[model samples]
Target: MPISRFPFFSSKRRSSEAFSLLRRFGPSKRIQSCNYGKSSRNGNGKPESNPLVNVDIQAPRSWGTYVIPGALLGFVGLAAIFHYNDERRAIPKGQGNKSSGNFVKGPIIGGPFTLIDTENQTITERNLRGKWVLLYFGYTSSPDVGPEQVQVMAKAIDKLEAKHTIKVLPVFVTIDPQRDTPSQLRAYLKEFDPRITGLTGPVSAVRQMAQEHRIYFKKVEEEGDDYLVESSHNMYLLNPNMEIVRCFGVEYNEDELADAVLKELKRTQN
Candidate 1:
């Protein structure tokens, strides 16, 4: 009966009363209403239809919910960019650095070592002289990353040989000497590129060669005699004098590798 307890107002009430009623509700329910109708004789003096009264509205989303996650994602992106840049900073070549842990501006790579080719021919680092070599160290039995890197090496050299005057020799030296014999190396490499000269030798020789190249590899047994070799996925670009020019990692795709190698060749030629 009282105006304070009974919130509804009677006819001829001031809008100030309605303002007081709206102030009682929290911010979320503060949708404005508009009443437009012909002047009527209704007992309550309210419009017959308040079209804007039931309008659907919502509160603005909190900045914390979206901003925190967005900031975290931005930070992660920056960290990744910095880490990638670090990998590239060790050696300067073309527009981007060669991707790998082993690098130029450091100790010597591409030392003299003896290895037998797929045909059992003695192929030493001396044999690689007077040749531009794109060399990778991996095992034939590698299931995933090894095949991809070898394929990249095969395709990149083929691309360079197509138009470019630079003749690059693609070489694969196996880490799994116990399994990757001359015959196995021949079969595995031929599938990707027949020109890829595969090399395999005794375990001690292979280990010594890997150390010379700063390549890390270890055999983890799976079941019985089956195992996997965890090794550095590095590819070395050697100049004609058998010196390491640049180091490529698993990061490079075929096209990128070809383009990078071409630029290095031109730089050296000039």
Candidate 2:
């Protein structure tokens, strides 16, 4: 009975060894933990080498994608701020600003000036104190925009004078005193309107006046005796008190100029 039991135990031990060998050599690892190094199995039963092809790296994405547009928006905001400041700086100091051809009340601008009129008489702001003045600073040699502006100004004055209530003195001051003598100024102004008072004086006096009124003028392209003078060419509307009320640029036509002056006149009347 003991020998028979030994045979049975030997057979059982061989069966256990056989099972262990099958675990070591057979496809038992397929049921165990996965091998992440080689993720997939090919048709030949070999593991695929490219882990990236099987792994979902696109999931759990980073939050850094919005940085560029946000940075660009910030840069654009800063640029706009700089541009606005530049525009503000470009406007004259005391004159707040104008909008779409509308005038705003600003600091009083002007100073006393001594200049000779076309009539060869010494003229000052005192002489024109009782009447409203439409004053302009320009040069006869202004090639492009000057004559047009003068024409518009003359037409505006004509229309204003035609109206019964308000009478305005139209004065043209030469930025180029060297070339615009009394005779030359008289003749030039008569072509526009005989009522247009043309003024010319010593360069120093003109310079001082221009500086006080914040006028900018420069001489360019000089040839022996003839040169071109460029100026702001601003037309100023002055009250009877000789204080500047508004400044007009070259943008206005005769009708527009007449309308603006009438508007100002009506405002003062009220």
Candidate 3:
């Protein structure tokens, strides 16, 4: 009789020399023994050994079957974490990320609309798909905000032309289209820069464009002049795809505007 740590299972070490001589190796490891000392053969022609009796090599079956697979899964999880971190770090700061591309390359913060240009052609959001457009939305009568920003945009385009082969079209979108008609816009633009093209269309279209660029404008009641209308003055830099890239405050400096244009040019070149 051999002792077993398992309560339900026991091992019978056959000490009979005749049985031991019939055994293949070591002591006879009786898988199960009948009280009458008989042996049974299974359908495979092998002895029906006891469940508790065998070489008992402790083959690390549990570790091989469960722990190794679990370890592999853990390794894959860790690798995924590392891969995500590496990709996140590779993105340039303030640029469009993998999620989507904005006009200026960050989170989108603008509106949408449709309008026409100087050519009397209908220009929708789709038309802006191929060229970088510097959209200037302001009133002609805006004493300081209107001309100053247009000039800054003109200079920025000039700098971009001098430094790179980028062709940026300056689009002057007038908020006071009621006062600044096509001829009025054309003349007003000449006073600042000849290259600046004035775009005037239907009032509805102008309003739509303003809404798209996140512009605020309203007609102010002036007691003396019926031709006067006040509007929110702002500049929108749009990408080749007619999307608002970035917006400039009424007080943005020329150098800052130039830098922004140049940065966009770099992104475009890339």
| TM-score on alpha carbons, each prediction | 0.62, 0.62, 0.55
TM-score for model 3?
Answer: 0.55
In candidate 2, what are the lDDT values of residues 38-66, reduced to their tens digit? Answer: 12457665656653322222233356667
Candidates 2 and 3 compared: the better one by lDDT is 2
Estimate the overall C-alpha local distance difference test score of candidate 2: 0.75
* Cα displacement (Å) at residue 186, model 2: 0.3
Show the colliding residue pairs in model 3: 31-50
Name the lDDT value of residue 104 in candidate 3.
46
Ranked by TM-score, the better of candidates 1 and 3 is: 1
- When summed lDDT is taken over every stretch of 10 residues in candidate 3, the lowest stretch is 91-100
- Predicted candidate 3 versus true structure: per-residue lDDT over 118-200, tens digit per residue: 55666565655687887777767877757787888888788777876667888888887677777677778888778887777
Using lDDT as the measure, the top candidate is 1
